[model samples]
Target: MIRKDRAVVWGRFVRTRSGLRHHHPMTRKIEEAQPTWFRLSEESWNEIREAYRNGATAKELAVRWKVSPSSIYRHAWEGGWSKKRSADADARAHAEAIAEEERADQTRPDPEAGLFGPPGADDEAMLGDPAALAEQAMAASVRAMRARLFVEAEKLARLSEAYGRMAEKRGGPAVTIETIDLETLYDIVMNKDGRVGERFRVDPDDPGPRDPILVRYWSHRYAEREAFKEQIRRVRANARKAACRAVGLDPDAPLPGF
Candidate 1:
């Protein structure tokens, strides 16, 4: 009985020892799997070297070393690692510099802004408001009409003298002068005398009868005078239209065609 009990105790001890030996490698692996921050006793450089040898990435080495990726890159460089990673970093930095320069250029002021001068000044003012521009045009047209009227009046006076002279030379009745409304004036000027010497005249030196020239000149002068008066009438009509428009009246209403 004593021999059998000793055999049992020896067998139990052998089994326990074998089990411990089997679990030892697994325990070492588990310890290795723990985070590097918890395994603080190991040197960071040594850890990096061991991790790199085991095919670890730079980011993994950075985390394990508790340092930046740039630090890992520096160490890799000093240790004669691949230069491709460094070249990639250089290319990235150059790209960033070019992007920054482009952004600055896009934010610069436009060159065209200076050539036309500053906003809200004389250059802008000359464009003129609609009402003021209309008034100025009307005034200029009235002045032109007045000048045309002066020229026509002088011609009419000459025609009156010529008619008196012709009547005296032919011993006939003197020509009559009449005042008529705007409608009659246009009709008479357009239809009278076949637009002969009354409308236009040849130069005095030209080989033509003075009577035909005088008749054509007078006719043309009359037409031109009527046209000038018509323009004045139209201007007045427009002024009235503008006034009516200011007062919210319809500008195209049948007041006059003028």
Candidate 2:
């Protein structure tokens, strides 16, 4: 029950009823009809601000906290939270890409494993037999060549897909080739035979047909793979010749080709 001396204006009781002279229930309800403004505690506001700066969107925060997006955006603006969001988002994307690449590297099969050696072919046991060594060497070389080509083709497919996506963007940065590692380039040059080097040589000086960077990397890698394979062939052939002479057979005899 309200005292006769007190009057209610809006929701609060006033000492004087100067303007609101009559205390009618209907008038009091109408005056107090406005909804209360939503507010967050200081601690909750700080948490929201930190989340916004750390790459969380205002809409996401609103849904998660059961609050309106306007409220989150308001606090975000007042607290200067928008500037860091894009930077944090980029950093998160970079980190995720690095993690995905590491995982792929871990799961990928090693292309160079057993390239020069046939499965279950003992080099020592075959040393006494010239024909056996020659056949094994040829089969091993064929298998190694096929493996290398398969890996190169897989890389090219993936590179093509990536470039296709990049092409969809207008006014995007031009695709750039990375500098070849000096040590790796040196190794490729040193291992090169006349045939492989001439066929797959990577000429950075070439001006026309500006292919993507990954295509250039693929060429360099293919050249290196072929050069290494050639070196293995020569080494294996010499070993077979030595074994033929040791077994009292003709060293210069033509080896059987697969």
lDDT (10s digit) by residue, model 2, range 135-239: 544555566557776664454444444444444443354432356677656666686556545555557887756446658878778899999999999999899
Q: How many residue-pair clashes does candidate 2 contain?
A: 0
User: Which window of ten consecutive residues has the lowest lDDT sum in model 2?
Assistant: 27-36
Candidate 2: what lDDT?
A: 0.63
Question: Which candidate gets the maximum TM-score versus the true structure?
Answer: 2
For all candidates in order, the CA lDDT equals 0.56, 0.63
How high a TM-score does candidate 1 get?
Answer: 0.18
Stretches off by above 4 angstroms in model 1 are 1-210, 254-258
Residue 160 in candidate 1, Cα distance off native in Å: 26
Q: State TM-scores per candidate.
A: 0.18, 0.23
